[model samples]
Target: MVDGATTGLFLDAAGMKALGAAIAIAITGYASAIAEKDIGTAAIGAMAENEGLFGKGLILTVIPETIVIFGLVVALLINSA
Candidate 1:
């Protein structure tokens, strides 16, 4: 076994804050990418069947990107504090 003092694998308050911010952004970005992928695939399929749906498909596909924007805001708040 190891001790905290000897191992020196601890995070101070600032480090913890940075880590939290990074985790928030990373997780949200990944989730948004996954959601966007599925939505984009569906949009493409719809657009293929009906050309008129191109505009709507594009808008729907981009909607998931809002998750990343929220994540960025959260990260900014975390770091600013």
Candidate 2:
């Protein structure tokens, strides 16, 4: 009952779901990389300190992970819609 011309132009729910999943993963991964970059710099700065700063350094470095968490939530919402 499906037409050939319309077949290529249309995607089933499953296809759309897959696309959403892929986009979610990609966005999260990109955000994770950015977070890592921030952490690396904080770590380097901590290394130069003579007093206690390990905990501060770690916290400052990983703070960028919030971006990834938000990205994940957005992706989930989009997929559900």
Candidate 3:
């Protein structure tokens, strides 16, 4: 009986950790999307004003993508733990 109870508790904890990792990834992805939206808008405006600014605008637009990459790394760490 004691073993069963301990096993159940361990499963519960593991489930919680999995859920937390999923939430972290989802929230960060959403935030990155929001940031990308604004950055894309600004980049478009800048590009319209000066065609030569395309490279800079592209870099700025892609910067927010790092948030998703970091989120994936964190999720992997959480799951590993």
Candidate 4:
């Protein structure tokens, strides 16, 4: 059992854990979005120069998506703990 009086901010251990998980996901998701935007811009330029480069550009643009996936995994781990 936990005491409410001890946690003046109203968040207990579980609440803190949830907050931590959320922060992890939010920050990583934001970072991934920024990375995707930059990569997508460059990829679009490359594709414009050579249409055949579309596939490679697409793959490069999507690589940043892994950051979000990692973030989700981290959130899951944090929440589970």
Residue range with the least summed lDDT across 10 consecutive positions in model 2: 3-12
Compute the lDDT for candidate 3: 0.88
Worst 10 residues of 3 by lDDT: 1-10
The collision pairs in model 3 are: none
lDDT of each: 0.88, 0.74, 0.88, 0.92
Best candidate, TM-score: 4
Q: How should the candidates be ordered by TM-score, best one leading?
A: 4, 1, 3, 2
Q: Write model 3 residue lDDT over 10-78, tens digit each, in one string.
A: 566677788879998999899899999999999999999999999999999989999989999999999
Candidate 2 residue runs with Cα over 4 Å from true position: 1-10
Q: Which tens-of-lDDT digit does each residue in 1-81 have in candidate 1?
A: 544553325776677788989999999999999999999999999988999999999999999899999999999999998
Query: For this target, which candidate reaches the highest lDDT against the unseen true structure?
Result: 4
> What's the lDDT of the predicted structure labeled candidate 1?
0.88
Q: Once model 1 is optimally superposed onto the true structure by TM-score, how far is the C-alpha of residue 12 displaced, in angstroms?
A: 2.1
Clashing pairs in 2: none
Measured against the true structure, the TM-scores of the candidates, in listed sequence, are 0.81, 0.64, 0.79, 0.85
How would you encode candidate 2's per-residue C-alpha lDDT over 1-81 as one tens digit per residue?
765553444676656676877787688879888778978776877778734777777777777777777767877787777
